[model samples]
Target: MLEARDTVEHEIWWEIKGGTSNVWYENWTKLGALNYVVPTDYPINEELVDVSDLIEGGAWNDQLLHQSFPADIAEHIKSEIYIDQLQGNWDRPWWMLTSTGRYTVNSAWNMLRHRDHEDSDFKQLCIKGVPFKIYFLLWRVLKGRIPTDDVLMKMKIPIASKCYCCSIPQQETIQHLFLTGQFATDVWQVFKNAVGIHMNLTQMKQVRYPCLKNAPFLWNELIDFLEGYKPILVSKIVYWNLPYDGWYKCNSDGASRGNPGPSSYGFCVRNCHGDLVYTECKELGINTSMVAKAMALKKGLMYCFENDLQPLIMETDSLIMKNVVEGIWECPWSIVAEVDIIKKLKARCNVLILHVYREGNSLAYFLTNLAFYFAGTSRFNSFVDLPSAGKRIINMDKQQIPNIRIRNAKNTSGMDIFT
Candidate 1:
């Protein structure tokens, strides 16, 4: 009929035939009809079996398009081909029947799936290349896939050696490195002293094995305790100034540049009889001048609170800082918070913030200079005799001062002593 029709009719007939071919091909694929190739001696009578039987129990009725092929079959073809694209195997020739106007979806899915599988295989190979014991230990520690200690001990180590620090005969493991080793105990002591917290130092198995296995919060506490204390201890110091009776005087200062750059703070406490009680210096990392001021204030407060000292007078060259602390003027929000903390600490002691001329704050200035010198090498936390270099500088400054003091003292007479 199509062959005998005029050009327009023939074109429509040809389109109908093509559409039918595509639909048949898609249905055949879904029903597994294509699994068997065309047989050489096919039975002519039964050649086209009723494919409709295969569609009865499946997802056919939900997709009928009001076309031919029992409503169910029509629906099946429309849905599986148009919506789900089940025959969409673009990697081979199978996808041609299922794709809509274009077959690119099948092509894209195949390419992406292949690439993903290849990348996954590559990663597996990379992981397999790592040494077995090292990999297992790291995996156990990181992923909580730990084997029993006995099983771990039986596993091969690249280097067969007992623990280095403790010399006890046992396989080197993360547990041993952190728990049983003498070095680990030393580290724990420093940790305990710094935070003022103590815990039983014993074998990993003794400290609640399940804490290591499931309680991540407890594990983190151990890690944080170990990591935080070393620096804190190195920076801790006792400082005092002024001697009573026969005691010597110790003075301290804190300075910051550009508001929040590297800061230097120092303190030297002297007994009533003029004997040096203790001295300390510190170089604080980038922090506001206000922060440095607060830190210095805290140091004094801590010293007084810890030592049971009274009538303690802390001095800084910053008059504005002093006034702010005394509530004589409003402080910037940044400074106020620190001032408030200091005030809270101050309430526990006989503490006073005295504003002095930068000149009068010479000892603190000298200590700050020393702090800068020891910035990276060591933290100034203990009572050390004055460094020779600092002593020389102090003596030199003192000697040069006699020549100028008389004239300055006369000129400055009647000025407010506090000013």
Candidate 2:
């Protein structure tokens, strides 16, 4: 088992959070043990024992870090190895081998069995109903481990490399033999026409594995797929409706760069005239998009209450959140406490939470995305203070310009329409 020390180190990673992880003892830095990376002269602050000591109010304390460590190390901690600083949980060991961060026999076996590892491209090859042979073939293709002409030539075999698939006598490289050759081009052309995808596929490095899995290998299956998904415009019911007089509407949205990763939320209070009253966008450290959404709504409610902006209608794009609030769906156990807080806030005011489509809630979405551009939470009280694009969206909404949501023609629900 000692032979697997390198493998074990490669597989397990410390997910940094507010609590549990010791600053010096744990492998949270990914550079190996934290003690080794520390400067010899720099004194480790006694107060900085836990990871939480490094964090402050959902962000890394930039000032404290620069004072505590060498400038480069402090920068790395606040930038590269940084979490959002409010993970709401203790630091834990995450299995790098699995998506769920949990260890499993199959994952362990795969790590041990595979001599050559590819850049996660082989993951798409393990499709449901796909054969193991296809999976193996694609895995080799991605890893460049297959005995192609170029690969075989590298093995010191005295042989000339030539492409038999194409009329041009190009060198039989992996890209030429499998992708750019005439026969391969013909095969792809057939699917390109069938799928109606208006994109170039020649970029070798930019291949998305999901597209490869979805593209039909069998011609007969391709025919059925095209037949099922013909081109047609489907009407989707989505638009911002004016709130009743003496009432204000709050629109909130939350999103993440990756689910349960770097996240943020935005919310706004708007009057019946479609004018923005107050808006705020903020980062939420590391959390799921669901948590971010819940936090957005919660913060929006809190803001309204604090400002005495009452009789509010809350609009969110998250359907699950709407259902959870209305008791129509099970609240995610992670966010049950948050949901309860929202419930109490709802009781405090005339709040009606409703689900809105992305098109209808474009302004909130735009606001939510603003967190990515700025360092911290940003606030807007006047329309002029908003970004130009945001102001345009507001103007469009006030002028009753419709936002369309695309749906399947087979399942059209007539509401908003444009030819």
Query: Which number leads on lDDT?
Result: 2
Candidate 1 TM-score over all chains jointly = 0.35
- Each candidate structure's count of clashing pairs: 24, 1
- Cα shift from native, residue 109, model 1 (Å): 48
Give lDDT tens digits, candidate 2, residues 1-419: 67876556556656664466777766676555556678777787777788778777877888998877778777767654534335567766766566455778787877888757555655667889998898888778888988888998889998888888788788888888779888888888889778665364423212543322344545577556645754456656567888889899999999988897999999988998999999999987788898899889888988998788878899999998999888898765445545766887788788889888889898899999998889877999999999999999899988888886876444234433433
Model 2 Cα shift for residue 90 (angstroms): 18
Position 80, candidate 1: lDDT: 28
Model 1 residue 205 lDDT? 31
As a TM-score, model 2 comes out at 0.50
Off by over 4 Å in 1: 1-250, 376-384, 392-419
Q: How accurate locally, in lDDT, is each candidate?
A: 0.49, 0.77
Tell how far residue 348 is off in model 1, in angstroms. Answer: 1.7
Candidate 2 runs further than 4 Å off: 1-230, 410-419
